[model samples]
Target chain A: EDKVVQSPLSLVVHEGDTVTLNCSYEVTNFRSLLWYKQEKKAPTFLFMLTSSGIEKKSGRLSSILDKKELFSILNITATQTGDSAIYLCAAPNNNAGNMLTFGGGTRLMVKP
Target chain B: SQTIHQWPATLVQPVGSPLSLECTVEGTSNPNLYWYRQAAGRGLQLLFYSVGIGQISSEVPQNLSASRPQDRQFILSSKKLLLSDSGFYLCAWSKGWGIQETQYFGPGTRLLVL
Candidate 1:
């Protein structure tokens, strides 16, 4: 079975602090890694990393995948209270039925 | 742009009761659909997926079942609700079978079985 593990299951940080979330995977027929930000409802798509070394960035959030290391990291800069949410990482399995194996997720809390 | 929707934002049902959750997509044609369940503090688990109408594929066998009737409509049904079924149910969609394609999620339906 494909497995995805995330580090620091939960974290609390003050405003303006920087946080890095980590996700490592052991998957079959690996294709890509995806990141999402979930508040109280559905998870919103953040970034999709298909290559190694190249980082995908948007505003205060950026992510990079290290295929060789079989891991990915999400970086949040100058965090704000609004940045608090459960960050999820997923990897797609290329078997018969296309599916994504997701990590347990990292719950982040940014306090002002 | 495409959008996905799920109905009955919240539901509370007794054990052995029936269930029917609906999901629909707009502005897209022949999209792949999926059903996922997430327990408290757990990751999303794929329950079922459909590549086309009446072509449902079960990921994990359980009390739940799914169906895709129209091009954009998917339904999740259960003959009998189990307490273990109480959780957040999410519906998703993608463009094709490409493993690299990103799946978009719905608002989700919170089901509590007592």
Candidate 2:
């Protein structure tokens, strides 16, 4: 079975602090790693990383995939209270019709 | 642009009751559909996926079953509900069967079985 593990299951930080969320996976025919942000409802797409060492960024959020290390990291710079939510990482399973195997997710609490 | 729709937004049912959750996609043709369950504070668990009509693949063997009656409509059904089945159900779709495609999700339906 494909497995994805994320580090620091929960974290609390003050506004303006930087946080890094980690996700590592073990799967066959790995294609890409994706990051999502979930507030109260559904998760919203953040970034999709396909190649190693190339970082995908959107405003204060950025992510990079290290295929050789079988891991990915999401970096949030100058975090704000609005950034508090569950950050999810997922890897697509090639043999399972491209179904995503998601990590347990990191619950971030940003306090102002 | 494509969009996925799932309803009702929330439901509370008694045990042994039947279940039918519907998912439909618009502005897309022959897309790959999927059903996922999310327990409290946990990640998504893949329940079923369909590549085409009448083709369903289950990732986990449970009391739930899925069907694709049409090209863009997928339904999840259970003859009898179990208390453990209570959770947030999500519906997703991808452009194709390729490994590189990204799956877009619906708002999800929260089901509570008491």
Candidate 3:
């Protein structure tokens, strides 16, 4: 079975502190890894990493995929209160369309 | 611009009652559709996915079933509900049937079974 695991299920950090969330996967025919930020309703897409060692960045958030290690990490720099949300990592298998195995997710709480 | 909409933002149903949830995508054609369930503070579990009309694939066997009656219309139905069926149901869509394609999600429906 394809599975994705994430570390530090929950974390609390002060404003301006940096945080790192990890995601590792064991999938067959791996294609791409994606990151999402969920606040209340639907989750919003953040980044998509395909090639290993290549970093994808958006503002204060950046992510990288290490296919050899079968893992990925999401880093948030200079965190703010608005950055508090559940971060989800997912990888879609090549044979399954619209089927993505997701990690348990990291619930981040940033306090000011 | 494409958008997905799910009906009945929230629902409360009794055990053994029937269930029907609808999801539709606008501004796209022959898109791949998916149905997923998420427990409280947990990851999403794939229930079913459709590559096209009349083509449905089940990932996990459960009390729920999905159907695609139209090109962009997907429905989740259950003849009898169970307590374990209570959760947040999400609908997602992608442009094509491929792993590289990015999937977009709807606001989702929250179901509570008592």
Candidate 4:
């Protein structure tokens, strides 16, 4: 079974604080890793990591994938109240066409 | 710009009742569509996916089924609803089927089965 596990299921931080969310997975054939931000209803895309050691960054958010260790990390720097959301990590199944396996997600609360 | 739309943002239904949820995407052609369910405090579960019109694939065996009649329209249906079916249903679309592309999601539909 392909499984994606995330640690620190929930976190509370003050504005301007930096947080690191972890995601590790076990699957048949590893293709790529992705991150999403869910506020209330729908999840928006964040980053997709396909190569190891190279980090993908956007504004205050950045993510990196480690293929050898089968893990990834999403780091949010200078977090703001608007950054409060559930951060999700996922990877596509190699056998199934575009079928994604997602983590439980890390609930982040940024207090102003 | 691409956009995805889902109808009936919220729904409440009784057990054993039939259900239908609609989703449509625009500004894209022959995109890959997917249906997913998110239970309380759980990860997203893939229910179904379609690569093109009239092509549907079931990722999980459940009371729900999906159909893609048009290239950008997908529908999720259930003949009989179950209590376990209550959750946030989401629709997503990607560019192609070969690579792991970023999926654009719809606003989502919250279903409550009594």
- For residues B1-114, what per-residue lDDT tens digits would candidate 1 score against the true structure? 799999989999999999999999998998888999999887899999888899999989899999998999999999999999999999999886554379899999999999
Predict model 3's lDDT versus the native.
0.92
TM-score of 2: 0.97
Off by over 4 Å in 1: B97-100
Q: Quickly count the clashes in candidate 2.
A: 0
lDDT score, residue B82, model 1?
Answer: 97
As a whole number from 0 to 100, the lDDT of residue B98 in candidate 3 is 44
TM-score on alpha carbons, each prediction? 0.97, 0.97, 0.96, 0.95
The weakest ten consecutive residues by lDDT in model 3 chain B span: B94-103
DockQ, ranked from best to worst: 1, 4, 2, 3
**Which candidate leads the pack in lDDT?**
1
**Weakest 10 consecutive residues, lDDT, candidate 4 chain A?**
A91-100
- Model 1, residue pairs in steric clash: none
Q: What's the C-alpha lDDT at position B12 in model 3?
A: 99
Give candidate 2's error at residue A5 in angstroms. Answer: 0.5
DockQ for every prediction shown? 0.70, 0.68, 0.66, 0.69
Give the Cα error of residue A101 in candidate 3, in Å.
0.8
Ranking by TM-score: 1, 2, 3, 4
